[model samples]
Target: MRRGASASHLDAAAAVDAALPAWLGLPNNAEKVLLTLRAARVAATARGVAATALGVAATAPVVAATALATTMAELLQRLFELQEGHKELLQRHEELRQRRM
Candidate 1:
């Protein structure tokens, strides 16, 4: 009975091993299929990372342009304020001169 049980277990193991390649849809080359699948996955991951990097690179010019526009607007506002202050000082100086005369 012990010998019979061991023989049955060995037969079962052999059957499973024989069926594995067919179960995985490979023609007696499961290792090749697994390696191909791994390579495909790595290629897909690399493509995704490259696409993200390209998206960031494409947006860089727009970001720089927006920053430059903002800086120019601030500088223009400061220039206008300074011009107003200068006009006011000139008016005050003219008034003082007339009073002295």
Candidate 2:
């Protein structure tokens, strides 16, 4: 059971990893953020899948899953914040560059 479950989990992960390049190729900033959110959703799914694959009814996996889900949620939130910060940083850099010109 563990072996088969492990193999299936690995297959799912490989499928997601394989599609990463296409996600990265998105041409627009909004699309990229959407892609990141998609990736985070995949990660959350992966955590649950992994827990189920382990076939453990233990509390540890449950706790871990909760922690992982929270972490992924926080990551998704930060991704948006970081995107805004990045745009601001670029604007400031451009302003400084213009001033020097």
Candidate 3:
């Protein structure tokens, strides 16, 4: 909110970062990131499996590219999840310490 981010965007980002493990912070968001990772992984695997089963060996490069893209997406998602959770933590810390006086 301090960033002047739109309410809906903030809420959507929060929603993404919720439902995850407490270890990941914002359980919901973490879960979302994990889900995205899982989905991407599944897609990559399916592409590979399909190509192999179809015996279209010439498509290996394309399949590999798809897998790489998915992997990069998963990494970026995890980074965003971590960043969003950190913002909440920093705000909480600032608020709590202010009341200690």
**Among all candidates shown, the one with the greatest lDDT:** 2
Best by TM-score: 2
Q: Which residue runs does candidate 2 get wrong by more than 4 Å? A: 1-65
Each candidate's TM vs. the true structure?
Answer: 0.36, 0.39, 0.36
lDDT (tens digit, per residue) of candidate 2 on 31-77 = 45555676677666766665676675435635354665567667767
Q: Global CA lDDT of candidate 3, please? A: 0.63
Residues 1-101 of candidate 1 have per-residue lDDT tens digits of 69999999999988775454547566534534544554456555544554464565432444343443455556556655664565577579879999999
lDDT-sorted candidate list, best first: 2, 3, 1
Better of 2 and 3 by TM-score: 2
* 4-93: candidate 3 lDDT, tens digit per residue: 568778897888655456554554456455656765676667656656755656455553455545665676667667756766885788
Q: Model 3 off-target regions past 4 Å?
A: 1-65
* Clashing residue pairs found in predicted model 2: none
How high is the lDDT of residue 74 in model 2? 78
Model 2, residue 101: distance off in Å is 1.5
In angstroms, what RMSD does candidate 3 have relative to the true structure?
10.9
